[model samples]
Target: MKFTLNTRKVLEFNRILNPLQNCLRMLVSKHELISLFTLFFLVYNLNMRSIISGDTLPTSLLPFCILEHRCVNLDSFGAYIETINNPYMFRQIDGHYLSQYPIVTPLIITPLYLVTYILLKISSCPIDMFNPSFQSIVLLMEKLSASSIASLSCIFVYLSIKNLTNKKIGIISALIYGFGTDTWTISSQALWQHGTVELLLAAMIYITIKNELLENKLNYVFLGFLSGLYILNRPSDSILALPVILYIFLKMNKENIKWFFALVIISGSFLLIYNIYYFGNFLGGYSSLSDGMELNMEVLSRLVGLLFSPSRGLFIYTPVFLFSVFGYLTIKDLPNEKLRFLLYALGLACILEIMVYSIFFWWWGGHCYGPRYLTGILPVLAIYLGLYMNKVSKEPNRYFKFLIFGLIGVFIIWSLFVQFVGAFYYPMGNWDSKPNVDENPQRLWDWNDTQIMRSFHAGPYAYDSRWILLFHHGFGNIYNKITKISNY
Candidate 1:
């Protein structure tokens, strides 16, 4: 065992790979010695942040982004996974919750989860995945999951680009994804948003290829399965898949064909398992848990909020992506075939998306479930904007291309700012990230961490301020002492 580990270390440190090569290193086969080394590096790199999350990082919502001493969504879903596995503690409804959670995200996580569990049990290892008590297994699983999310997103983007355009487009798209702001943010998190969204987008793209472009009707089975999984993630974007499904039915509008039944059965089987077990219903585990169904007179207000809302809307945080969509659309013509196809598809998707988003806006109040709601369609949108870019200046001068790339470069820099700089300096988020900032919704001013800290209820940082509370807890007394002195 000692020799084996020593050899693994040698392979891991053999060379420092560039970001692209480093990200793609995991494709190495399970049986290969080199792959094993890469895996070790991946794990070590993730655990390098142990100071933040007790080695595994909080799977919790607030802490993962903000980085506090807490485990993230484990309680919501991970705990559900645990409860189901523990037979004696199992409640039927609890089991059903696991079965049903828009569970597409959880399902993507299952393989790594199972592997960690198996290793823990097999080797009698006491590695806990959540706390230090279970830190060993949890940390290990998180590291693997993080890498998997990164690697899979790369593959997914490549496939989506390749399917929509060509090999070059695919490589460029994947590179953008690897380096892009949102993808980078999502991937780095110790939570489900990145992995889950990636799966949902991939599934949508797969359906488009299978039903419309590819000649394979048999492939709809995977399409339907992924569609069901898509619903599990954001549920709102599930409507977006209608185009692909409609494509499947267009050829056989009159008949309930054999392939139709196969699609239903294949997708339904997996989903039914989730639904019946999760929500005690055959079809509604995730939707049942969503915040959108209830109707109100002010549903009109919610609708307005959906498009322009501070938190969930497209225009809120990243306005450039929105402008890029606009810039792409206004262009007169696109020169290339692949660019034209991508533009047309994206235009159609965007219009379809707008219609659906409008319909649901009043219902859900703009999906503040993080920025994840709109991210599903980003890959398609990026290509759309890229084409318009080609059209806007049929020829981008070196300076213009540099300017465009540099503006994108600014976004890249800002992306790093949001994650690393924003985390420490901005903490909860900056002024731009706050919701309903103009009218100030909740019952106070700066109702964010600042207001909460200053108020009598005070919450976590009542004594100083959220800024002080944030770094202090992570730093323990050292931060508090410095702040305490600064107080003088």
Candidate 2:
């Protein structure tokens, strides 16, 4: 009778815990949840956000302006603008100052700003842009929002690769994309358009691969929308859209194709109206900047600089991507015919991106770290890396496999270290503006005065002490007070 009673009790206990156990399993198994946890881990590990560009200054403010002032123009921020005097980032349109960069990024991140605005209102925290506390809040929100978008890109990167190969390859490639590329140092740091562009591009690739695996009309529609946004985000890189359009046209059914075109037209119409309203032109505020872009023999030097220069070179900053060259050379050996063709199309896009940027007057991308212009093509490079990894995993010769993996490990560590400097120690030495890189373009190629070397000499924590103290103290106090209350 005693044994029977104990067995019944154990059975009852298990029955009571079954729901909790299943919930835990579901959470662990979900890819998105894992990605979110990874994002938080990266954010917590850094514990600092670097606002490194004047280009993103207007974007940081536009979201708050849209929510509070109910206007796109930066008239309310006139005092702040006057203080900063960043002429290149803003333009006077219709007698009102507005962001010169694409407005879509600001609009995308407006919700986060809205949430911050609401919380401040609830807590009676003064919402002044000039106030240190308010400024800290804005900076925190920018980091979180940008990091979140970058994380989303990594998620898609993993999914795309997983679909192409296997789970191990997917996870490894995603980590490389998330940490070893500019996605970590640049896109996750501030409200740069690159983060949004990356997310859109990664999603496009994921959807393309998913569609190839299982045909779906909805995939075409999503691809079309992303394509429209991608072009709008960076019009100069519109050449990157060729592969996507080709894929849609060739693979999608007539009805799906019609839907795709309709979505693209709709997104285009939105841009058209916004541009016409603000700048009185379809090209929007970028028209003046585009005038300087020309194809010339001088582009050859830029092509070399963009590839190999110490300051702005893609390969210099992120050497892990060099494996992508091997991946491209072995493209013909890929078993999936559709994926192989897609990779070829992407290769063409990457080539065109390099050629187009090389012709631009500001090919070094001005006052930024490490090949910012080449950031858009990183997703393609990451996929290629994944391809190489997949091939390496299947190599029959253990010795050769060990040698290749060892080489990749070295590159990965170096890439991560370079990005670490960019995220934490950039601009500490004032390398960009000491002589102004634009005025002294030769500084970019100088091995003795490389941005990486200068940044390292400056040491970590190179940003303003006042801002750092305010962020830590202000948030730290609030956190402690909350803990006290919860304990009570």
Candidate 3:
């Protein structure tokens, strides 16, 4: 009787599908189906598989950073709070503790923490909130916050490129933005400011593109709000949005300008209030951090290392971005001068971001993977890639088509391999292993032992990939042997 009922349901489902098969085929192309699968592939791996393997702030400091952890109450002593070193929290002048990082990211994900806490309590779980396992729960929350926003960023990339070019180009743009770039390795890994900033930046680009096609006052208002959130997430990386802001300014009339300014002022006012309350300054926590950093020859050297060094270079991690050079060269072929100007302005903004990172003391982006500072500008580069794809598709030569696409395929494979290995396979602190060079006192910069190569060696050597160790001296020994370094 059960078999008969199952057979009837299967037959009914097939009968329904048989009538709609042709309609479904017509509505969804094979290419679109493949593209959607690719989108899901990138999003799932980048988010779910990229959780912390070691020494990540999201795991170690996020609970305290968000004020979720506190000293145990007498009534619930040893049951509710776990006493730990609290490495990332700083005591305020008034004796209250806050994270050294800005509050925007923790604030954004607070509700997730609340929900997780509620679920834990409802289940009558006998877990301490400060146990190492508790961080795993918050990490799940981090994955949801980062991945969901990142998925939205990818969709906006598709929509922006589709409006500017075609669906194929849009799909490729989103893939490149989500997977074939540092956006995958860094932004999708945790609830970092860079990931949130990337989402906001992507939204800004999409809105900017939409406003260009059809002027909308509300768009500018939203852009203003996003700009504020962008700064709050990461103050320095906010430069990534300047091009869009300038483009908006260039197109606005008196009435539109008034609307934009009104929203901008409101957003700015919130930032000021948040800052004054926390850090006793209108500029916020970043104001305390801005002093005593300057540019020099050493800074220039670190900049080169960040861009071209074998281990840390942005291009090495995501080779698909090399197409961005062509993106600049082919601007004349763009549909209009306004779009071309937008590209130029955005390019300058990217350069400005690099310069900002260069001047900073720790140019290597401490304890993370691959040029993490540039995550915000990656969507801009993806647009450039869309332009490159658009240009090559228009060419008439068959050999040129084969050669260009073949090259792109190779680079895309390399990027996917790097990101996948970086997410799940590579040791978190594998690169920071050498003795201090005279040039770098912190031993963070390594030019020859690229992270890709380190990952290859990590598994074979049974390296300490554990997330809990304060330092892995074995990696340092391995680095010395590989780099053949003596006393400097």
Instruction: Highest lDDT: give the candidate number.
Output: 2
TM-scores for candidates 1 onward, in order: 0.58, 0.88, 0.78
Q: Which candidate gets the maximum TM-score versus the true structure?
A: 2
Flag the better candidate by TM-score, 1 or 3. Answer: 3
Q: How many backbone clashes does candidate 3 have?
A: 1
lDDT assessment of candidate 2: 0.82
TM-score of 2: 0.88
Taken over the whole model, the C-alpha lDDT of each candidate is: 0.45, 0.82, 0.66
Ranking by lDDT: 2, 3, 1
How far in Å is the alpha carbon of 177 misplaced in model 3? Answer: 1.8
Off-target runs (Cα >4 Å) in candidate 3 are: 1-50, 53-86, 89-91, 111-118, 124-128, 131-133, 433-448, 460-488
Residue 277, candidate 1: C-alpha displacement in angstroms: 5.4
In candidate 1, stretches whose alpha carbon ends up further than 4 angstroms from where it belongs are 1-100, 126-131, 162-169, 206-214, 232-234, 250-261, 287-313, 326-370, 389-406, 419-488
**Deviation from truth (RMSD, Å), model 3:** 11.6
* Ten-residue stretch with the least lDDT total in model 1: 60-69
**Model 2: residues with Cα > 4 Å off, grouped in runs:** 1-37, 40-47, 462-488
On a 0 to 100 scale, what is the lDDT of residue 169 in model 2?
91
The digit string of per-residue lDDT tens for model 1 on 1-488 reads 99999988877766554555755654553333344334423532432331122112333221221122222123343453454334331223532322223444444566456543443344344333334324333443454465566556556555655554565545544555444434433444444454566655664565455444544655655665565556545555655555555555555643434555566566657656655544566544344433534444655554444444544344333444654665566434534433344345556765565555544423322212224445556666655444434443444477766677667656645433333321222223323235543345321122233311222232211122332342344234444555666798
